[model samples]
Target: MRCLLPLLLLLVAASVAKAADFAARFDDLVRTATPRQLYALLYDLPKGGDLHNHAGGSDRPEWMFEILTDPARNGGDAFYTRARFGPETEPAARYRLIRRRTYEQLAPAARAGYVPLADLSPAERIAWANAFRLDAPGEGRDEFFNVIWPRRGDLSQNLDARLELLVVNLQAFAAEGLAYLETQFGLDGLVTPDGRALTPAEAAPLIERRLAQPDVVATGVVVRFQDTVIRFRPDAEARLSEIYAFVAAHRDRWVGINMAGIESDPRGRPLRFLSTLRRLRAQHPTLSLSFHAGEMDGADSHVRDTLLLGASRLGHAVNLIKDPDTLLLLQQQQRVLVEINLISNRLLGYVPDLTQHPFPEYLRTGVPVCLNTDDRGMWDSNLTDEYFTAVTTYRLSWPEVVQLGRNSLARAFVQPEVKAKLLAAYETRIAAFEQKYGAGSPTISDALGKVEKVKPVTYGYAKRTWGLEFR
Candidate 1:
């Protein structure tokens, strides 16, 4: 026993030394590497999944424009962006991308005011596209919550467009080494390019077929849907019941339901649907719930109430840091995972300074957390950027990075058998990654190729702040 104890202590000491050495090496790289070099390393890192994604918000403005302007693609449908000139309208007013079908249906005078995106001059197109993103300094909550969606109108409801965007996202995420994606997609309200509504029954087979395509299959990313309902709508309860029922029936493709939209709106209070959820649970209890809570800056018990609503995960629990008791509960219980979207939070004006964010605190306090791209396309960023932000901003240890990756899949709403397989695969992939890059590895550029070549998308934040010189 004495000899065994001594040997065990020696092995433990060696393991600790190895971990410390890796951390030191990683820290050195972070500190000394240029922006491009750091980006290469992160681009090559294996991210487990993105947990808080909004499907409608996951398309780049340019990509959307490509779809909208192509007559062959969008069933000959066209789109127009409202132009602003005089003092009467807001600058954001110039940014709305309206469907031509809807626009032409408007009064002739109203229709005359907008211009086809295709006919716009090159500079005009660029300016209109920029309006879809929060690239400008003054753009924030109002622009995102109010201006953007109203402009998108029925564009997101286009079934063919959404399916195509799904493939795009899967390919991009796969290139970045993300293996799973649980994004919010409503099952209803799908429309054809010509404006005919598609029943959920008709839409299901089409979506499944697209998902089974060769390119999507090649991405090797497991995709699951969450039936998302806006919480603040007057018919929220009815919508929640309908979506919950839909998810319950389509458990094979959909894993759960996510409640989102403006949290500060009184109509969307967490408790508003508690009884409805409880009633639904009585019938369809297995559906997972990962809700958007703690998003507001106001001091309130939304997080606690959301827990009472039975959320397995909390999306953007930014304000949880403000509620000491709820924070303590999260730390002590560790029952819920916090989906941290560092870039989205910053872009949305929730956390202006990344340093002041409570992500590291959540890690230290034993609350499970994972880095995610809440709306990567909208932010003009990706999974790599999220990891880069976390590492550079928080100085995360290698183990912390691995743990965050593990936590993402571990807390995912996938089936138990699939979860086990995902965890095992993650372990194997992480082991291989560490073996390649852990310590005494080649410089990032040598190890992972040039950053500009590796990263598929260039962030607007980078372009605005540092320019495109690095890329």
Candidate 2:
């Protein structure tokens, strides 16, 4: 008993010392100055490869909205529908979903004629701008996208319009600090406002002919044209064949294919989609699938369903947390990258708020998770804002931010050599900045004091699978 007393004392001392170190590290982080120093640490960070992005206008809202309305594209249909919650939750008198001019819909909902898309009251042209008028609004996912539908009528079947919008946004993205984007743009079966069915094959030609101009492919900016599938389409098999063929024929231009909107999609479509996908793979062999699997609100059944479908990459497979087995699959395979969209979940009422978002938990355990803006313009968010939220809300430090960016780069869809090329350049710059500034600043500041020098950590973080630790 006497001997054990000393041993226990030793153990307690060690625990307390470790706790002190942890507290110190965090306290220093809170005092960080200039979001840019955090940016310098995280800026140009290898975002383990972006896996969550919409096809058109994934850039900025202003970039998306104004470009679409460009006289060159089309002087088109654009309106705003204020989104809202229930009567019990919202004390604003009534719930609504109104169709008003996008410009007029600008005022805050607290003002008159403001319907939160819950229950809307239409406003006239001048009043529309008075109510809600802005070419580029906040970056919430729903707000960004809700505007799209009202304007869809004015932008359909015009391939150049889509490309121009994307191109314009890409430039905006670069200006805003993003290095790359992996989007599933241009849908085939997706209905236009007038209800026209547009396919990848049709949209591909327009983009392809444009890329034929040389500057498109030479930009080194990666653009992945993801051929899409509607979950449980009655004609799933036939459409699957068409996409497989499209990808095969345009392998040079196309990166892969993905299944979209499969979560609540009816038709027992998941099983059928997987069965057809497996058959398609056997036939074509290289038709890669980045399926939107297990975005389940409350179940793990879809995780297994996605694996059965032979998905190489998993988009929004957020619900994988519900099952331990799927967690192992993600760790072992390390191939399926999840597209994390914190802002989207909040606006869409997926998890109530961003804190419940799964990325930090996914990362702590070593899963291949990447940060993406999802649909920034629609959601009224940007990559920077998402990164900021993660660091503050999730209490992520510089190292973890580095880790997330590293994960994004690792899981990126870019080819091996190309990724290596970018990662090398990215790391070199980081190393120089760190060495020039310091190993790690207790806090980043704009005042330009404190950081004497900064040096980069050599090589990137090793890619590994971390099991679920949060649950």
Candidate 3:
């Protein structure tokens, strides 16, 4: 037994040494690789899952434009945008970019201000595209929370458009090497082109049929959903109960419940839902909870309070560092995971200077953390951009990068068998990636040549932030 103990210790030490060596090599590559090469490598790197994604917010503007403008895909629905607001325009509608049913109800002057989405001039097209994202210099949380979602307007109510967007995301994520997605998707409030509302039961089958299509299956990405409720609504508790039941009933695809809203809203305080959550928990089978907590300008107990509401994961726990007790608890327990959205936080003004983000602190101190694209479409970014930001900003080592991917899958609210398969697949991919990029392999220039062939897709954020443009 004594001899075996020494051998085991020696084996562990060798494993640590090997990991450290790979990390050193990865650091060297990061230091030497140009912006473009680094981006390509990150883009090609295997990712585990996106746990904090929003279905509507994650749709790329260009993708949405293509789908919306196509009558065949959009169910013959015509959308109009307020290209130029008039004095008669309601204050709320002044900046709204698109409307469907409401366009006909507007006053003549207001109606005149709107032009069919397909009829927009060249400059209007650029403006419309820019309006969907936080691309301007001074745009922040108010512009995002207030204007961005409203701009979608009635387009968001279209069931076909939403389903098409999901397929687009699946293809995009697959291209970038993502293995799993747990998007926060809602089936409520959907309508046909003529504005006939559909029940959840009716909307769900359409989603199922679309997902079962050969194109969706070809992506090979495991997809699950969490139905979200705006936390600040007056009937949020009732809504939470309803969503809880809905998720339980639809456990085949929907696995969790999430509470999302602007964190600053006092009515959405985390503790307010504790009683309702406890009551619901007693009735329903265990459903995963991931609440948006600590995503505030000022720090408080929201992160801790959210844990009390039975959340196993916290979304945008940006201000979690402020609560010492909670931080310590997380570090020790290592039970809950924090979904970190770097670009989202920076663009939304939560962390204007990302160097000050608490993500590294959480990661280094033993709290489970994973990088995610919270609203990648609005940020005009992708999962690779998040990893690029983390690596360059934090100088993460190779082992750290691998750990992040492992953490994401480990913490995902997925079936046990699915999780095991994903983890195994991730390990295999990581091993192959390491072999491809390891020492004594192709020269960096050769790597760059191969990466250029891949023709990775980039957007405004990539070009603006890192001066990288792969088109």
Candidate 4:
């Protein structure tokens, strides 16, 4: 027994030594590589999943333009935007963007103020596209929360466009080496081409049919969904009940329920739905709950209240650090995960400076945490940017990067067998990555050559933040 114990100890020591070697190599790469090369390396790195994504909010404006302009893909839907506001424009109709269906129903004078999306001049098109994202200086949460969603207008009613966007997102994530995606894909406001509201049951089959297509299957991205409820609405409780039941009925593809909306609103407080959630949990015990908690500007017990409502995951737990008891609970239990959205928080002014973010604290202190692109399109960024931000800002070690990826999958609301497969794949891929980049491997320049061939798609955020331009 003593002889076996010595051998086991030797193995453990060797493993630790190898991990330390890889960490040193990763630090060297970060120190020596240019911003572009480092970005490419992280872009090529294997990632587990995106668990806090909003399907609609993740659609890039370029993708939206392509889908909207293509008649065949968009189900012949026409879109319009207000090019000029006049006295005839109603207070609500003064939004910058609108759909053709909504434009048609507007007063003639108000309709005259709008132009077809395709008819916009080049400059107008650029301006229109820019409106969907936080591209300009001084743009923050008010612009994002007040205008961006409303600008989506009636596009949310088009199931075809939404499904196509999903496939596009899958392809994009697949290219970035992500293997799983758990997006919040709500079908609450879907309407038929002729303007009839469809039930979630009716809309779900369309989504199922679209996902079954060969194009979607080719991406090799395992996709699951969470039905979302806008918690600030007056009817949010009823909506949550309906969504919970819908999610329970659609466990095949739908795995959980998420409450989203501005967290600072008193109406959307975490405890508001406690009784409803408890009643729902009594009958539907298996459904997972991941709520938007601790996203406020000030300290509060929303994180604790969200836990009280039986949430196993918390989105944007920015203020979580303020609640010492809850933070300690999370650290000791290590059961629930905090979905950290660095770009979203920064863009929304929740954390103006990421260096002050509590993510590093949460991670180093044994709290389970994972990086996510909460709304990539709005930020004009991707998963790679999130990793790049963490590595550069926090100086993450090799094992820390691997653990972040693992945490995302481990805490995902996916089936056990699927999660197991994903975890195994991630382990294998990350091991290969370490071996390829660690000491005594290829030259850094040669490694960069291989990385440059990846051709990661960059946007305003990458260009503005990192001066990275990808062709």
Candidate 5:
């Protein structure tokens, strides 16, 4: 018994040592590296698609501020101001879409101290726009998603504006190395102008008119289901039917539907969403079906119930982690993809940070997880930024990032052939990138000044799934 206790102690100590080694390595990489070096390790990497999106925040915040303040455009927001919270910590301040400054300084101004999810203040908004301090961890996720709830419905509708907004956002994402996106659009179904519902045909004109723009279409737009908020209306089902039928007709533009919003709508049921999806799938089996599942720590019943709702993609899906059997069923089924947003989760207070996140367990167990930025504007993030948070914080290597990228492409709403083609292109990029710039993660160690691994050499990344040796 005494010998066994020493053996156990040694094992535990060794485990702790390994963890400390990884953390020290991470700190070295972050601290000693320049943004440019960090960007290279980050730049031109072909991310598959952004499965999770909030139309308002998915793009750059300056774009939103630009629209709000542009003399050429029109929205109802008023003048900006600030309340004195602290010298360095003014929770309120005026922000403007000033064109003269560097592109990073733009932000929107407003009346009162509206502390929305991202801290609705000029200073905070400006900081977020610049990607300054954007990588820090910890906050409330339920509030993160729901806090912006008041604005999403109002901000999403302007097709022309959003189309323009998305083009700029796409260019920015591309600059950071993303090539594809399963970008969600059109949540206007919840509110209709003049109280007249958007008939399927009307929705087509609403969308096609925007997609007609070359810049808009160049971004690779995929419409998530379009619906107005129906939590209060009598015609929730009818409206959904309209949206589904519209997708059936224009399957190419409208890719899928996600039942976003707080769970537990008396109407937010699998039968309703499934009935709509099942009907839509009959015509467009190719159409994707994703949902914001028990982002809530909802009732156990809600988690399982949402899974059965026939969703192809599950965004957030934090609570579902609580039900292991259901998690297994999802893994076995394989069609379901999770939009795991580490920053979003921490910001929304799901877990303290990536260290506490369930991603390692979920990914190791075979449940397909796709990293995403749920609300870029609010979270003050981009898809690649979210990817970075996943890596160093979670201790994922170059190989896993490759797997994550492939997982995203596979789980994307695009056709199978498109995914194949995209992966092929990535192979070409990796080959060229490898010859010029080294392929490994740069980690400094106690024994060595700087060590970098050539990813292709070490982790056999392929056009599809990661190399078997890794598993």
Candidate 6:
């Protein structure tokens, strides 16, 4: 026993030494690596899952153009952009995509104001992309909330377009080594190119069939949907009840319910849905809730009230620092996981200075926090951008980064069996990454060669910010 004890002690000491050496090496890389190199490393990192994605918001404008312009994939459908010229009465240049009859079908009077998206000249195409993304300097919250969404026109009203978007998002996430994705989507007004509305019940099967396609299946990225109710809408309660029923019926593909909207509006207060959610629980007791709370600039009790709303996951929780009790509940008890969207918060003008973000506070205090792409396409970013922001801004340790992935899978609303499989797979993948990138091992560049490096859409923004250009 004594002999075994001495040997065990030696093994323990060696393990500790190895860990310390890896830490030193990681810290050195963090300090010395160029933004490009660091971005490459992050791109190859195993991000377990994205739990707070919005399907429509993740649509890249370039990709959208490709999807909308291709005749074979409903691209031949006529779409128009609401263009504002100089001397317009709006705050900024605003454009929205509208479904209008074809050039041949429309009367000359009706066709006078609309321009076909397919026939847009190069300059017009650039203008359309700019209008869709939050890529402009002065464009921020209002543009995102008001202009960008409406610009999609009837695009969101088409399930096939949505399926294509989901496929692209999944493919992108898979390329970045994401094991799962929980994106918010609703089939409320989904229609065909000919304007045939499909009910949620009908849309669910089509979505499942599309997801089961060979290409999507080959990616091996598990995906589920959360029906999002626009909280500030007048019929939010009625919409909530309908989504709850839809989610209950489509539990295979739909897992949770999320209320997302401009929270600063008084109508979006957490307490407003308290009784409604309680009643919803009485009927559909198993429904999971991931509430967007505390996304405000000022300190308020919204976070506390959201907890009262019984959300298993809190999206944003930006103002949690102001409420000590709620912070303790989340941190000390680890009662719920906070979905942190660093890029979204910054780009949306909620937390402009990332250093002031409560992500590190929540993480270090033992609150289960995971990185997510809240509106990656809108931000012209993705999961890697979120990690980059968190790691660079907060100087996260390697273990902390790994724990973020673990927390993402841990808090996901996937089935228990699927979650277990995902968690196990994530552990293996991360271990391989650590092993490959450990001290005295190959450099990040060498390790990167073995993995796929997806060129991120936000690279331009990162380059401008870091003063580093890509080849």
Top lDDT prediction, candidate number:
4
TM-score computed on alpha carbons, candidate 3: 0.94
lDDT of 1 at 18: 69
TM-scores, all candidates, are 0.91, 0.68, 0.94, 0.94, 0.67, 0.91
User: What are the runs in model 2 whose C-alpha is more than 4 Å off?
Assistant: 1-30, 34-48, 57-61, 73-151, 187-205, 209-220, 436-471
Model 3 misplaced stretches (Cα beyond 4 Å): 1-21, 87-100, 105-107, 439-452
**Taking the candidates one at a time, how many backbone clashes does each contain?**
0, 72, 0, 0, 12, 2
> lDDT of model 6 at residue 443?
73
RMSD of each: 3.7, 12.4, 2.9, 2.8, 13.0, 3.7
lDDT per prediction? 0.82, 0.55, 0.87, 0.88, 0.55, 0.80
For model 1, the local distance difference test gives: 0.82
lDDT string, candidate 2, 1-471, tens digits: 998999989986864454344344434544554443443333333343456777543534344345444445422333233233345533222222222343253566534534323123443322222222112334233333344433343233445556766676554455444556667764553333334556666666767676565555444456666766666657767877887788877776666777765366566446777566666767775666677776657865877777777776777766888888888877776777677777556555566566777777777776777677766554444565566557757877555665566666666656677768766665554444443334343333422344223221111000011111110
Q: Distance (Å) between predicted and true CA of 219, model 3? A: 1.3
lDDT of 6 by residue, 29-136 (tens): 677666776776788888998999999999888888777766556534656654534455353324456664433565766456556677778888888787777887
Please write out the lDDT profile of model 4 over residues 259-345, one tens digit for every residue: 999988898988899999889988885799999999988999999999999999999999999999999999999999999999999
What shift in Å separates residue 203 of candidate 3 from its native position after superposition?
1.0
- List the candidate 6 regions with Cα displacement exceeding 4 Å: 1-21, 83-86, 89-94, 100-107, 439-458, 468-471
For model 6, state the Cα shift of residue 11 in Å. Answer: 12
Which digits, one per residue and each the tens of the lDDT, describe model 3 over residues 1-471? Answer: 987999989977875666676676677678988888888889989999999999999988789888988877777787787778658755446546454677877888768888888888889888778888899899888878887887778877888888889899999999999999999998768878887898888888888998999999999999999999999999999999888888999988998989998989999998999999999989988999999999998979899999999999999898889999999999999999999999999999899999999999999999999999999999999999999999999989898899999999999999989999999899888877765676434566555555566668888899999888996
Write out the backbone clash pairs for model 6. 96-151, 97-151
